[model samples]
Target: MSCEQVTTTYINAYYEDMEKLGVRRATLEPRATEHIADIVRLVDTLLTKGMAYRVDGDVYFQVDRYPAYGRLSKRNLDDLQAGARVDVDERKRHPMDFALWKGSRPGEPSWDSPWGPGRPGWHIECSAMAMRHLGETFDIHGGGMDLIFPHHENEIAQSCGATDKEFARYWVHNGFVQINHEKMSKSLGNFFTIREIFQQSEWPDTVTGEMMRYFLLSTHYRGPLDFSDQSLKEAKSALNGFYDLFERLNESDPSHGAADQLLQEATVRTRTAFVAAMEDDLNTPNALAALQTLRGEANKALEAGLSGEMRRMVRQEFRALGVVLGLLQTDTWRFKGQVPQRASGDAESTAKTLSDEEIAVKLAARLAAKKSKNYTLADQLRAELASHGITIEDRPDGTSRWKR
Candidate 1:
């Protein structure tokens, strides 16, 4: 495929995966190639303003023109020059000066510009795209921590030099994600894709989108996340607890008595803690912990037999707080029994847990086995159902109810 086609395919797949993970779509999606005209205009402005120079159709930004170049990256020009990765190009004015536009080569995508046939440089493309969509100055710019250096620093220098205005008011750089305490790299044989994670057969329980979402948020965004099957399992188990509480709230009567002050106090405390944690640099780990504490209090209240009104109040609070973290929003009944199908592969062929109807059938057989005094068969059936995450509660009426 062509470069543009490959990029388009990747972008479409990225958006599809984000949607599956419950992330909302961005208000605007801008591609660098689509903004070529804007990029050319910015490059022309830099050239006219003497911030950039063209050599044999190749345009390079002059770092010496922008005095505050290394302010963002917090390195001096001497240090950057010492550690520069650029080749020894005597044609450039300075070693640290970077490309604003690269002269096109044969069989490469190119556009006509004042200089010649070429394409915008990597850093200039981002600056041009952002300014085109969000004006000269925007509130925030975010990227991976690795981009804080040359990429972001160059963006600042070129953008501010051209417009004589601040480019972005805030810069937010997030940390990397590691696999099992090691850097996730293809050379290391640990690189994984979202689809691969969902279709992994290492775990008995099928990994769902929600479970992956929760696993991501469980750690602080600014900290390196150590992703593993165990971490995913922990996330899934935590969500199960929340869903279990939701199920109890749904089944409990919600119209009989006054609210309990203790439970009410717990709910209020949870809200305060949740908000405070979020405000503190989006510290999701602490926020989740606050909700977990509330979950514990909620379970206690349930065991103590809360009034219907209090139960409803607690449930509403849980949902409201959970919405902020993008958790606990699925329907309680559906979430309880929902088992996402694994992607087609050997994983898909693996044995899956029984559906609710199938579980009921097994429960009925177990009941009949007990009625016939076949204690061995009844015990075997009970063990089998338990292994599939089902719990059977036998009632005094000679019937059993099953839950997951």
Candidate 2:
């Protein structure tokens, strides 16, 4: 596919996945760089400042002049030159000098530039787009950790050289994802695209975008992430637990017992710890640990017959933290079909969906048959439910619960 077609498909899938995961942005709508005038104007400013110059129809940035060029990545110019590929073009003033605009070849995309009919280089496009959407100085700049070397470094050098101001206040880099101890790549046969991951639905335990999002948060943002089937399964389980807790709390009656002081105290401590973790450079793993603590405390309290207020508090704690983490926002009943979860592999996909009224009638009929001492009739009703892939267990207190 062409670049425009590929980008449209990718960005649409990206926005849809983000929306399902409860992530939204004030901006990030579609944009284009078709206005060659703006790009030409930008090149004119850089050329006027003498930080950039044209040579043989190609424009290059003079890296030697930008003193703080390596401040972000902290590599000295000498060391960078030693580590970089040798540039055979002795015409360049320095080997580290990068392209700002490249003269168009036979059939490549071209735009009218002061130098000639050419195209903006990769680094220049990023700098231009950033300054266009956000001002010269913005709060944060983020990309993959691999981009720190040339892509982000060139962006900083160009943007700051033109505006003579800090480009972005904070620079955030996310770690790369490896597959089973190997770097994921198309040549390596391990690379998985956003569409590939989300489109997997044949297997009952297939990972969803929800699980993929959870797997991303399983480690720190700056830490190397390993993408494997096991990791996705674990992420699915972890995410499932949150929905499980939501369902449990929803089913329990909070009106029976008194206000649980112990549960309330746990909530405050957990929140405090969570806030501290976030302040400490967005330590998501530690913050998630704090949430697990609250989940544990809430489970223990509710299991011991805590009051409705206690359940409410527990639900509130989960809901509030979930909002911050962008998880568990969907309704619990709708998570794995319209019922509580069963201890099986992906019940939502395997089990038949049923309405609330149908479940109620089945439960009532089973109860009536059991009350009449008609074991055969009760067994038949139980077998009928099993046919629909629903599982039910009767309590000693004469109550029965069912889930699919």
Best by lDDT: 1
lDDT of 2 by residue, 170-222 (tens): 98999888988788899998888755555553222222656777788879999
lDDT of each structure? 0.83, 0.76
| Shift in Å, residue 267, candidate 1 | 1.9
In terms of TM-score, which candidate is strongest? 1
Candidate 1 lDDT tens digits, 37-80: 99999999999999999899899999999999999889888997
Q: What is the lDDT of candidate 2?
A: 0.76
The regions of model 1 sitting more than 4 angstroms off are 201-207, 254-259, 333-353, 367-377, 389-404
On the 0 to 100 scale, the lDDT of residue 117 in model 2 is 84
Q: Per-candidate RMSD vs. true structure? A: 3.3, 4.5
Cα distance off (Å), candidate 1, residue 15: 2.5
Residue 14 displacement (Å), model 1: 1.9
